[model samples]
Target: MATFNLKTVAALLFLILSGCATYQTKVNDARNAIASENPEQAVALLKPLAEEESRDQLVYLLDYATALQQARKFKESAQAYQKAAQIAEVQDYYSVSKITASLVLTEEMAQYKGDDYEKVLINAMNAVNYLEMGNLDEALVEVKQLNLKLYKYRTEAKKNYEQNPYAYYLGAMIWEAQRSFDDAYIAYKNVYDIDPNYGPIKADLLRSARLAQRPDELSKWQKQFGESAPSVDLKNSGEVVLIFEQGWGPRKESRPENRRFPQLKPVYARTQRAKLEVANQSATTNEIFSVERVAIKTLNDDYARLVGSRVAGIGAKAVLADQVRQKNELLGAVAWIALNATDRADVRQWSTLPESFQIARMTLKPGKYKVKAIGLDAYGSESGEQMPEREIEVRAGKKVFVSWRSVR
Candidate 1:
């Protein structure tokens, strides 16, 4: 009887040892599979162990969650992570245990829905709570880790859109926030087509798609979405104020003869006729004029005549002087120019003029003109006669304002 009892006891001990060896081997294999980045293999190895009676339930759950995450099974991975977290809480393990749990939950929440959609939503809510509590970095870390999981969820949800059409809509929002507009557009469109009762999202998707064709339209849509349109400031006076910057010098004479002749003489003799001929020529023809050292005779002409005559390249220079003298007459006068809505974009054309002037104000047509000061020696005779260019546009009955700055 004693010998029989010893044999039974030894056999039972041997069986128990063998079972432990098998469990340890399987656990080690699963770990190795995970190390190799083969989540599918790890899962295949660990699932049976997780179900076994001898293995630690918490260890099984944690490994399973890690494997699912690696395999891009976000929903399942999230559930497993939650279970591991619960186990950790039950065991009172805080640091790495809680952190890992929170990270998985956050990522799952950010992802599109899957079979574990409810869990994902819960975790996402928790993540938001954590973020609100000033643990943003940790919450973000969770979001980062779940990228692959979310991608898998998106792919799966797309394949079965009828099961949850809302997934595509949510995906679109995620993509839009990330600035992936193209993908977002498609996703939103899908949601609109599949589910008409999606409330404002359908209209929003259509609007976004239309506005994407033009930037201006996009701005309008954005304003409408925000429930605030930009205010347009309209001036009732129909007058534009021209503020001039000081510090422009007169055109320097190219030669001594430039100083000898009256500034009006050379301009009347040469420049005006040349410009008229050039203006009359066919647009296709390209003519080049060589400007050697040229001189101006004088600066004395009404605005109309000054604008008309092109002598001595003096038409532009004459216009510049007239503008200065007119401004000086006003004594701290400012030039006002009338502009139409179309004129705003063209106002920069005035900058092409010589250094003697700057644009001050802009208004639509039907405006008046007020000029300021023309200082002495404001006009110069030099080798290079730097004349300011005129950029003022005037319509019938509308006034434009301009100011002159003397060149030192």
Candidate 2:
């Protein structure tokens, strides 16, 4: 056998460690493209990157699909999301090589499986995309899959996990549209169970109860709120629900509490929410959920295990370096530097996500109307940012879904 060349090995390790880091520059380019309202450019940048079945696959897939969705290519977005959902189904099931690297070095060296919440959002986002494409059937399918995923997560985690209220709400709406009032009532009830405080939850519940002939539920709500359900003559009225995406979701950074594993960094969102105007009536959005908050909680949940694994890995590398030091001091020093140089918290996250999800709902008589969406501040004042005026035709007894996004 040939003699081991420590110098050559050390030099090669240095190069490998340095080169194995993420494509931060490319990711930033795609982010900049989306922020500048140029999603096509973002798509071009991430198209090839997403094809690599390596550590960055999930991140790139998410960014690419998000860009496609932002560009209003609903069909394309749905396809991309479908591909992502398949990968997410097998959460944390990376290849043997990825597992070895993660164990020997850092989790950052492994394929990014995404936070649990992010995995769930894959289907939730797809459900909405299906809604925009006016394919209620597919939307329902995605919702069912999303529900199944959440069920599995809760069972595995052995506790309650977050449920997407918007998904449930949309499912209810779709069921009602299909005249499946009984199913619609249950779906709406799920949304209420998750968040009864949601501004429109009661109104929706009341409507669903009357439609489904749930007299007891209707009376209970009426007594509690001391008000009847807002009369929406479903036979003649039309409804619209707006899903608003505002600012950017939280990012991860090293924090004092646990520097070994990153913490959720605060997002400085300029626009807090959005305001919608239609048919001489308007409603300001309310925060349904904070993606950033969920992100922080998930990070904390995984903190202890990750920090312990990282410490053990570093300790093993130190011992190896010490053993090598007895043979060649220079090579040992280089090897130590190379290994520790790449030691960092796995901060990669789905940066394209919105800071929070907000919603606005309205019911109007069937007609043609011009709709406008304006960004707002914390105090219910306009932020001087708005989507272009859009005209929507509402048919009698039908519902519509509209989505607006702002990168504040």
lDDT of 1 by residue, 45-79 (tens): 76774556331554465556556544556556656
Compare the candidates by TM-score and give the number of the best one: 2
| Cα displacement (Å) at residue 283, model 2 | 1.8
lDDT, model 1? 0.35
lDDT of candidate model 2 versus the reference? 0.80
Query: How does each model score on TM-score?
Result: 0.23, 0.93
Candidate 2 Cα deviation (angstroms), residue 12:
5.3
- Report residue 356 deviation for candidate 2 (angstroms): 1.4
List, residue by residue over 178-212, the lDDT tens digit for candidate 2.
78999999998898889888887788788889988
Q: RMSD, model 2, all Cα superposed? A: 2.4
